[model samples]
Target chain A: MPVRLYLSHVGKSFTMHLQGGTTIPVVSGVDFSVGEGECVVLGGPSGAGKSSILKMIYGNYRCDQGQILVTVGDEIVNVADSEPRKILQLRKDVIGYVSQFLRVIPRVPAVEVVAEPLILQGADEGKALARARDLLTRLNVPERLWGLPPATFSGGEQQRVNIARGFIAHYPLLLLDEPTASLDAANRAVVVELVAEKKQDGVAMVGILHDQDVRDRISDRIVDVTAFRAEAA
Target chain B: MTDFFSDDPLLQVNGVTRYYGDRIGCRNVSFQLWPGEVLAIVGESGSGKTTLLNCLSTRLAPTAGAIEYRMRDGAMRNLYQLGEAERRLLMRTDWGFVHQNAADGLRMTVSAGANVGERLMAVGDRHYGHIRETATDWLGRVEIEADRIDDDPRSFSGGMRQRLQIARNLVTHPRLVFMDEPTGGLDVSVQARLLDLLRRLVADLGLSVVIVTHDLAVARLLSHRIMVMRHGEVIETGLTDQVLDDPREPYTQLLVSSILQV
Candidate 1:
């Protein structure tokens, strides 16, 4: 039950030049948190700044005002004012992000995609390959297709490879952008179960989702971003 | 397998068998999709739902089967028999496909409007203004804000990109729209809204659709009939209500029961 992340009064804005030259408020005074091993589901209408919040959490975009305090273990790091390099380091070693669009490495087999993070993190090549293979096997990305590049795989198979990549590293904080959007029923269930299983290992997850049924199956805490947007307006 | 017929079968899969060196993808998979009807193909990841769609779209050649399409001039055509030029023509004019990932169906670097209007340009509609208007109309039909049409699809949220992809396909108003997990990447509220938009658009346009999804909830919401596949084969095919409510097969029962409603 330890605190893993905390964002207080986060405000992001943009300066828009009108006929009279004025500024517009895009997001104002948003706040939420995730604890160690807890999942916070963020849902809202399109353009409600759902992805923006993820960007803020991952330190991609800077907040104009307020503080974002992220707890890595016991120490609380103030991300609002932290240097970009510091944040980058934090993400590389501790944060695992799965974008909605799969970023495939051309000419690399599906199994190698999952192992890339591990290889980057300095894990032994053989060991990393072994773990990646196990993860793909568990997620049901067929063994025969492991050698084939993800470019040839179907939408669901590509997504499975992406999931394997995100979870293979086993970072404490996993930020997923619609991880199971294209999967068939069986693959979707496997993803839900996989996340639920990982939660037992004390990983904190924040994901943007459109599937309420899938959300209910895995989430313990749901943060409705639409409500936040309405309040801001 | 039981036999059935539709008034105008745009997609006719007869004795379709696909295998990868003896690992079965699907066997004797047969179905008929008529005009204006939404037939859903439901299965898990390995169930071969996508394989069937790929074979029909001619993205992948079936090992042993024939995919026949009834053309506009009261003539039946075999899609596989066509050469590269003819196949490309079918993709441009006769068929539309919306992949689960919006990026798959769309060019991320281009504006949303261009992504929707590419098919138009491919078929020789070079008027920029007309293409823009049509793109805007389809975007509005899918409930995306018209103002964002000029923005690169790379900047759009997942749900918005998906809507744009649907708009991109439907702007051509093709006879058959094959959707693979159209709402798979969205959250529940987003999914509900997207499903509502799809239902309204499908009803209004009478667009024939074949959707592949793992979500039975989606099947119940949008499909007129459902086809359940397991391990690359169709196990059950019936009306959505009948199959979902009273599945005759054990695998179907498991899939139905596993749905955790929010």
Candidate 2:
């Protein structure tokens, strides 16, 4: 197995216009790599830029310096430099992100939110929805709520939906930012099992997590975002 | 739960029917809502989810059946039992709304603080200093900076504007809130933060909410129960996890499958 996602000397800074255009640097000169079937955990205190690094990898935030590269099959793409269409295509197939919350189209059912990806990839809608149900069930989302929209769901329930949506697609690379932040201990265990299964399937993952147990269970290596935090400071 | 009126539902909707000219808006819709509960309505466009919501909110008159709501005084009365003026006042005092567009829910010309304080004012708060202080506190809770208090919502970003709108509607501490795709158009990052905030506020306040959205994730995070509608009728209704995990209905199965994953 080779490196699926690579980062070297990554840096990011925020221009706070409110603070009289003060440029506040957060991450600087961070380096890491995630290989096939490997899980690299970014562990550190809050505000240490663990999420910023993950954001840079997912192309949500731009890195000021260094390479944030991802290998989609054999082609290596710099997430920071990719075009919008290229990033979207990569997002659709290669790289997946499970952020803290579940963002979705209103009035859609829980099953459709999870199953829609497969349907777009040409899978039968019925089959896709059924598979979505399987994931939701495994994650412990209520059976009755499948038909309802999720706007009224609990924080923990919402996070499960985000997890289901992220895991529904088979990607070469995955990013998890406190994926279990809102989950209780019981649900957290389910996510741990899911991550293990994903690892066995050869999907490489990089996650920013504070839960020491989950981090210990999933990490093949630990990248201390504190290292970058120190540099930025 | 008290055995006396223990089964007394907070809202009892029976055989409600709504029509749009010759078109059926929704037919024979019936459900019960409890205190401190959230209910989500889900369906594709023209599936009658919107029509069903309109009827429940009394935005549209139902052609048949009855909708009963339990007032704060614990009296169950038919919706039309009250005068038109009383119904309008009840909507203002007891219910809150968060629309798909922040502009629709907020006074864009007003300051962010004023937008939140207006709800308090509506309920008869006259102390200018107290209202301002409370407004500032809510702004902080919603992750809005104090500096933005004097700024108008029209100049704010989409996420900020939406947050301001939520603060406004919540100021009066309404028991029931009606939201139509509250996080529909925001970016994923923004939407996540908003959902977390909403969950906290709802729990802290013990609010009952009737929300209509197409997104299953929102329902799962915020509601205890869910109702699935298709073509103006509820095809399935159950506990959030149960319905999503083990859908018994065919239409529900398609809906579960219809979600587009990121």
Candidate 3:
């Protein structure tokens, strides 16, 4: 399989400017790659920088040193050093990320929230909403709740909505951050099926899944995050 | 949709800085706004977001730096270098500024039809029948009753007046619009309604918007990218979701975390 995402010697550390510039190193020398149709799980304990690695890959967090390359239609763009505009363009056209929580514009209905990714991609509004409704149905989100904002939904329902939104668009690379954290058994199974579908579509996925059953079922490889943990001086 | 002009930015601001005597209004702010993109300037009170907005809209002169806008004729002209008449024409035909107060943007004493029709007149529309018909159509589009077209803005509710202001500005089909706290002082439900309307209209019009607001929710709803101002300087700028979800700057992180999650 072709590599869709590759990270070489990626590192991250936070500086506490308010605390007299105290530096806290999070992760260092991180290296991983996800191939098309492959799902790689970042496995480690809490605070092991799994989420940080994911954010770095998504361009939400800037890496200190290294190349985070994403293949876009024959061109390989490095996320670590790309301009903000380029990162935004890459996000719109290439990457899809589902964080642990669903953060959306207040009062935007759940269906619109799910449809927004596709709409941003310039898909027709009617078809985008139809696809959103289909995803919501597949995720077991109540039909009535589709018209309501996900903010009012239960934790599990909101996660499902988030999942639907993330999966609504066709992105070459998808990042899943605790996607099934709040899901029930049935919903979790649905997420597993969604992962299988993405794999069938030849998407490259990197996820931080704590649910061992879901992780074991979906992960083609487990990258131990603790090996990249930066030691405190 | 062609490759030639599609990649050209609609507006470009290079190192725009403004000062109120010894104090900084905004310092060295710069960004490019592409067509059909909405960029939000966000910060706490007194962060110079409004000052930046005013400078971008040509309402206030900057102490330094230049703003260049791509005209309908496809020539990039420095806003400061334009003749007064040309600037006024651009304001009337290609640009719109929606103030925080509807009264500031509207003629409160005039009937809503006149308020909307006045913009048409500014752009050389003279036929009374056509102007009134267009005004009535706009009122319907903004969710105001067609019969309310004859009512003056002062007689309308705050939200209605604001919507009227929007209709008046959009009547000429301006390609670029600058909004300053467009939903600042409305009830939550009312704000939601207005936001929904604004979002739809912006998308439909393919407008390039520069919106200044302290409300992060408003910024999130209306903007594609966000520039966070602090102490008269842009502390952080990025795609809206990336900045809001995982802010890199400490101040930005504080601002994002401080929002009451009710």
Candidate 4:
């Protein structure tokens, strides 16, 4: 299988400039590679730096050291050191991230939110909306809520809307951060089926699934993050 | 990734700085606006977002820095270096500025039809019949009734007047539009409708716009990228969602959080 994403010796930490410049180390020497059509789960307890690794891969957080290389067509770009513009371009064309919460844009319909990514990629408006409607239906979002903004939806409803939006567009490498955290059994099963479809399409996925059943079913390999724990000085 | 329709920016501002007698109005601001893209300048009042917008539109000159615009002839010219007559011609033909106060942008003494037709006249359209026909078409496009075309803007309500201002500006098919709080004075429901109309027209016309607004919601709905200003300097700039969702700067984070949630 072709490797879609690779990270080696990756490290990250936070500095409290207000608190006398104290450096708090988070993770170090994190090494992993996810191949096409494979779903790799980051397994560990809380505070094990799983989310940070995902953010680094998505170029949301700047990694302190080593490489976070993403395969884009024939080019390999390092997210850790690339310019902000390059990372933004990579995000639009290569990576897709589904964060835990949905950042709602006011007055935009829920269906438009899901259809926006496809539209930004130059898909026809009618076809994008059709696909968005299809995903929203599959995820069991109430039909009445599709035309309204997701801001007022309950936590679980919002999560499903976020999932529908995330899964609407096809990305070669998708990063999932607690995507199913608020979903119930039926919707969680839908997500699992969605993951299977992505794998069949040869997408490489890295996710943090705390739900053991879902994790066990989808993960081809588990990269335990405890080994990458950074020691305090 | 490769745009076949000319990757060159439509407007470029390099280190633009303005001073109001030693106190900075805006300082060292720089960014590029591509064709068919909307860039929002967002900050609290006194943050110099207005100053930057004025400088970009040539309504106000900067103390330092250059503002270059790509003309319809495909030549880049420094706005400050252009002659007064040429600048006026560009303002009437290629550029449009929508003020926060509708009265400021419109002629209260003239009928809404005349308000929209005046720009056509400025650009050398001589046929009165064709100009009035186009004016009526634009009034309808902005959701104002065609019957309202003959009424003066002073007789219209605030929202109607604002919509008329937009029609007047857009009637010329300007490539770039500068909006300063275009939805500022309207009611919530009215603002939503106007924003919907503006979004459609912007997309349909493929306009490049630089809009200054204190409302983050307006910024999110209209802009592709956002530049957050603080004390006359750009504090942080990024993709609109990235800046709003995961702001890196503490000030930006506070601004995003301060938005009233329902």
In candidate 1, what are the lDDT values of residues A1-233, reduced to their tens digit? 88777778887754332213334455667788898889998877878878777776776555667888877766778867765334544665677888646655345678877897887566899999999999898889889999987877887778888888888886788887888786778878888887887799888889887787888888888887765552323
DockQ for every model, please. 0.01, 0.02, 0.36, 0.23
| Full candidate order by DockQ, most accurate first | 3, 4, 2, 1
Which portions of model 1 show Cα errors greater than 4 Å? A1-233, B1-6
Q: Candidate 2, after superposition: displacement of residue B162 in Å?
A: 1.6
Model 2 earns a TM-score of 0.54
Query: Which should have the higher lDDT, number 1 or number 2?
Result: 2
The top-ranked prediction according to TM-score is: 3
Q: Quote the positional error of residue A170 for candidate 2 in Å.
A: 37
TM-score of chain B of 3: 0.98
Q: Candidate 2's residue-wise lDDT over A1-233, tens digit each?
A: 79898898888876543445556779888888889999999878888888778877876665678998888777889877764335546776788888778765556678888887676455788888888999999999999988887878887787798789888878889998889886788889988998998999899999988888888888899887777774434
Is 1 or 4 the stronger prediction by lDDT? 4
* For candidate 3, the TM-score of chain A alone relative to the native chain A: 0.97
Q: Worst 10-residue stretch by lDDT in candidate 4 chain A?
A: A14-23
Candidate 4 lDDT by residue in tens digits, B1-262: 2321356888988999999999999999988888887889999999999999999999999999999999999999999999999999999999999999999999999999999999999988999999999999999999889888888988999999999999999998999999999999889989988898898899878898899999999998888789999999999997676677656676786798789987
- My TM-score estimates for the predictions, one after another, are 0.52, 0.54, 0.93, 0.87
List iRMS (one decimal) for every candidate: 27.1, 22.8, 4.0, 4.7
